[model samples]
Target chain A: MSDTKTKKKRKEKPPIEEPLLAPGHRACSGCGESLGAKLVMDAAGPNTYATCCTGCLEVFSTPYPESAWKMPWIHSLFENSSAVAAGIEAALIAQGRDKDVNIIAMGGDGGTADIGIGCLSGMLERGHNILYVCFDNEAYMNTGVQRSGLTPFDARTSTSPPGKRSWGNKTTKKNLPGIAGAHGIPYVATATVGYPNDLINKVKKALKIQGPKYMQVHVPCPLGWIHPTDQTIEIAKLAVLTGLIPIYEMEYGEVTRVRKIGKNRRPVEDYLKPQGRFRHLFAKGAEAEEELEKIRQIAEDNIKKFGLA
Target chain B: MARPRPAGYVAEPGSSKANKTGSWRTEKPVFLHDTCTDCRICVLVCPDGIIFGADSIYDADFDFCKGCGICAAECPVDDIEMAPEVR
Candidate 1:
């Protein structure tokens, strides 16, 4: 017994031999979606299957002759990743292997909050044993920065360009986590790539639960967001700290845990000024001030709704 | 003549490792090990996922390191600096 105790005490942290998401994929330098994908797969471990929609994640990781994923992965159309995952789960159940394997469905905001939302809703309503992860970069980044349903108000996109008669995007971001929680699933959570440990822990916890689980990870795109490539993590953290993005957990349509902003709450400009996409909002005009106030109000509303104070 | 694989499935998984992305790097991260705290934030933040180490010894596999500078930018101890690539 004493020798066993010594051995346990002397155990060292094991070195990582091979990342589940291997390197040499064609993701741009400092791409937050790739990091988020790696974190999710690392948390899910070796006995998991992943299905991805047609988006940047699928494109960059799986060019014609090569693939970065080290696990069993599949890709379907832009709007059927969740449906494909449901099929995988059904097959596993037929084989009496459902309990041993985990299923994950992944897509970008364009695929998740826009085109794939119907399939995602069906999967959630059917109560499949799967986790759906939405990598929300706030636009259709794979197709050259077109605006999507999750795009925030007054953010510039190729389609929503600011011109003589219009601001950037006219509509506010859809409350996707709320919509996911509305399905009364077992687990729903919002996370950002800024906090890696929190993100990993949430993924692990969601995988442990048996019912439908949803996670929307705020992955910043340096090219799309027009920020310095090295500033991806900083920009992501700023989004949370500025109260524009509230990190919280929901269980069965109720908020259970929230990452409190407290004294660290910053104004939205701290988050906006760094990205060139929001540059038009800073131009000198009374209209700009009004729009900035509206954006601030959105952040304030989020802080109040999630009780982040 | 041969038929193509179904849905273009990869016969060898993780074959992207063969594509050396290090050539895309304009700047390379130089690690100052003497002052390193071994927090491993560099490993966590790397989009390339090329850094690997354990027990206070961390280093990046230069073969796949795209030198995004995220590791250096996120390093709390300032032990990493993005220097211009010499070669």
Candidate 2:
């Protein structure tokens, strides 16, 4: 009788109202982009133009002539989605039809954090009214997970292969939100599919903003990630808990608010473990895990450095 | 007997994050000398090559720091923390 039996009730999040990106589409079982796109469509659909860069979303959603999208959709090259969206906005604005249409430029990490950045930056600087959402699955998933600027270091991708001498993805994931903030856009926010309500809230916010706005959604890919299909949300939740990815919002080139940090941020390993993507860390005679821990530490630093809490 | 749920705040539903702040992406790092052991862990751990100095002390080039805290972790003691809440 000495032990206090305490049963904490599960925080019953209200039932998610409706589905946006319907089923029967072909996406990898654990595709984070799919989940992210679902939230985007729910907030920006029925009267929006969705443009995707040539990547996994493009390949899967539009498998040559037979597309799964019922909405107005367009597929363009890797580095020009922004420019194309800009042109669409111009045409709409010129025709005095801007109030009715919403344009969203979607791409992977390679496109936004790398090739498509220049155009995306231009669109924001020009104050083009478009919602640019990047589903960051870390690397170029379609082109074989190469070490793109957004790919985190020490994580094994096809190109950033672990070898006897080199670590996986030597460089860090480029700060896309921070980079986008510099343009002095009307709005900017970061979200993850794990928190659908918050993610949807952000997309709604981005859509309501007058000038250009950006939303970087953390989408964990099972293909390049080496994680599981079921634990996609959990791993993502861990990312925020460990301060690896701080959910935040910025306005006019300034950070405004951040999500509260979970109480127990038990080292980086707590976030790194339980996934095959970080399996090498526990392997015998390898500092790969140690190196990853450093990354986790870096993520924690981001929280303190940014005052995410 | 009951367990306590942690106090965490969430953005109101259907609300917008349109508030403008004085600065964006400007997270300045402050060193807590009293808490610092001066182990120089930060000196070696800085991803950007900007945290070196004599006597194992460290300095961050905010322009170049990129706000990536290899230095904060490098500090053997918890000497480095984020600046106090401000614009």
Which prediction has the highest lDDT against the true structure?
1
- The local distance difference test score of model 1 is 0.92
Quality of candidate 1's docking, in CAPRI categories? medium
Query: TM-scores across all candidates?
Result: 0.95, 0.72
Model 1, span A120-222: residue lDDT tens = 9999999999999999999998889999999999999999999788889999999999999999999999999999999999999999999999999999999
Show model 2 residue runs off by greater than 4 Å: A1-20, A284-290, B1-87
lDDT at A155 for candidate 1?
A: 93
The candidate scoring highest on TM-score is 1
Question: Model 2, A65-151: lDDT tens per residue?
Answer: 355555666766888888889998898889998886789989888888888999888988888889999988888888777767887
Model 1 segments more than 4 A misplaced: A1-11, B1-7
Best prediction by DockQ:
1
**What are the interface RMSDs of all the models?**
5.7, 20.7
Where does candidate 2 clash, by residue pair?
A254-B23, A254-B24, A255-B24, B41-B74, B42-B74, B42-B75
